[model samples]
Target: MTAFPLLLLALAILSEVTATVCLRMASAGGGRWWIGVVAGYLTAFTLLAAVLAQGMALGVAYGIWAAAGVALTAVISRLVFKEPLTWVMSLGLVLIVGGVLLIETGAAH
Candidate 1:
């Protein structure tokens, strides 16, 4: 994919991750934070839609999106929430990244 579409996908993943983090914080009676949650998800979906308009296949785009979102969310969760990151989880993240790379490369062919 071209840089612009990839950028959109990255933005989508970041937006989703942000929304998830906000939701976690909002769980403690911070109802106002739900606005952020809504905005983030909406922004992400919009960007993802734009990416699809660019002709990226669903399997490749969504596979990369989901993998990056999960890995980034886990790392950020550890930093922001004092969540523990076991070695196994680290391995899982690496595997997720590797799998996404494989999907990306396969899509290029």
Candidate 2:
């Protein structure tokens, strides 16, 4: 299939993960970070809408969005906040990625 939808979906996922990280940062100590939180989420949703308009299937787009967002957010948390990432949680993230891959490949066919 075309890659445009996947591009938009990737943007959506990036925006969402950025927003989530900013939200946590804001809650921690910096109220100014809330600006990033709001902007990131708004951008994310806008990108998501654009993806849908571009004919990306909702199931596939949203699945990839959520899976990638969760996976990236977890990694960011570990790096930025020094949060723990157990092996089990890492495996779960792997499964999420695998599921998203399945959805994408299925949509391609």
Candidate 3:
């Protein structure tokens, strides 16, 4: 029960990150690639709703998903788009991960 919602939340976030990457790629002359971006976002939101439908608490699920999404999207941006990554960015990602962990742990209680 819990695992299912969490899985869907993670998938939603990942899809969102993928969508953002695809959007950036499209903007950089990857013609018609925006379609992928649009589709990704659509899928992300749909999956997000499914997570909620599975009984995930809205605050916990949404917060964790957003934080994880931002961290992962940044990582993907650096890897797939060759975007610059600084020490600050790495530190920020770590903090985001930590924060998300804390939130999830709290929610468990």
Task: Identify the candidate with maximal lDDT.
Answer: 1
Report lDDT (CA) for all predictions.
0.91, 0.89, 0.85
Question: What order do you get sorting by TM-score, best first?
Answer: 1, 2, 3
lDDT of 1 at 65: 92
List TM-scores for all candidates, in order.
Answer: 0.93, 0.91, 0.86
TM-score of 1: 0.93
Instruction: Evaluate model 2: give its TM-score.
Output: 0.91
Over 1-109, each residue of candidate 3 has an lDDT whose tens digit, in order, gives: 6588878888899889888888888988998889989999999999999998888878778888888888787778788778888999889888877887788788889
Model 1 error, position 18 (Å):
0.7
Error of 3 at 5 (Å): 1.4
Candidate order by lDDT, highest to lowest?
A: 1, 2, 3
**Cα shift from native, residue 74, model 3 (Å):** 1.6
Best by TM-score: 1
| Residue 84 displacement in candidate 2 (angstroms) | 0.6
